[model samples]
Target: MKLVCTCIGCAIEASCPYSAPRFYLGEGQAWARHFTEDLTRENIVKGLKETNYGRCVYKSDNNVVDHQVVNMEFTGGATATFSMCGFTRHQERRIQIMGTKGEIRGEEGKIKVMDFVTHENTEIQIPEQTSGHGGGDSGIVRSFLKEVCGYNGSEGLTSASASVRSHLMAFAAEQSRLNNGQSIELDDFYKKLLVQV
Candidate 1:
């Protein structure tokens, strides 16, 4: 079974809202696609250090079998509950764009555009009934396919740049938590990545 959530902090083992795992847990290319851009060794080390799982019982011996059993216990017990585990931070971001003609707000795959001048509001129903992350998968795929086929340029429910920005925001939040909740500049973080590339 596959489960998907905005972050690991939002997962509930007993009654998971998203069908996919809290984090990307699949193997092979499927797993690689979601994290390809941020799969640097430095990022891995940083995530590990921030989580502090090094001191947990799961790392006692470093043997594969022992580690797997211990890790399962650690991740499955009550201690792994969303509110108890503090390794990952939870966040829901809403982007609002105000144009002279109208305004657009998007979050969780739903988008609403309201025209202030005409007092008219339009709600877009994301096509495809997805059970993961409130239909984010459907919205993402539709937007990507539209762009790939050159049907539209930047007019879609969500663009690639927007998705990248959201991912970067999550990454920045993780960095902030690791640095004792210091404020992270999103633009600077994105700029740094571009420099690296």
Candidate 2:
């Protein structure tokens, strides 16, 4: 199996909310719901002001890398590639997955599926949602609440250890990137961290 993921950001003057002030300070703000329970204009504006939503990416003093790509191999021998870039005309994420029997591709809320055996092709278009990440934010929130309410089921929820491993993978990837793309074994990296701790 193989997977490829990309996150590309738009320019500062583009209409994308990631780099445009309109998303937080202008009339076209789409993420106001994330601010306060009150949908009042004053509250939304005030909440956004307290955050860094409208900051210019080019002038930011943070150490965020503008572009990066990480290649990973899973324990099962599956390979994956994740890439991020801030120099694009549009802000969007694209993902593609290839397996033994079929392949799937998605971008900008549209998904395509292909069956290798029957040679069938299918396309799916997700409805545009204002609730953020195609309404996935609410889904995750609800799932978290369920867990907090004593739900023991693992469906739709990531295990804590699995989550930690995912984060460690990212850290190791960044370490490899800093070391000129030198390969680093995840198990050894974790052991070294444990020793330091």
In terms of TM-score, which candidate is strongest?
Answer: 2
Candidate 2 clashing pairs, residues 3+ apart or interchain: none
- Cα lDDT of model 1 by residue, 1-197, tens digit: 72222223432432643212323332222332343446554543334334422123322343322111011112233221112232323434466666668889886557899998999988986554534455567767777787788874456657666768668866776666567667676678789889989
TM-score of 1: 0.36
- Candidate 2 regions exceeding 4 Å error are 1-28, 31-60, 149-156
Give the distance in Å from residue 182's predicted Cα in candidate 2 to where it truly belongs.
1.4
RMSD after CA superposition, every candidate: 16.1, 8.9
Candidate 1: minimum summed lDDT over ten consecutive residues — where?
65-74
Candidate 1 clashing pairs, residues 3+ apart or interchain:
2-19, 2-20, 3-19, 3-20, 3-21, 4-20
Tens-place lDDT digits, model 2, residues 1-197: 62211112334356544543455445445556566667676776566545554344555565867899898888999999999998775567889999999999988888999999999999999888666666668777787787888876665455577778889998998899889999989999999999999
Cα TM-score per model: 0.36, 0.69
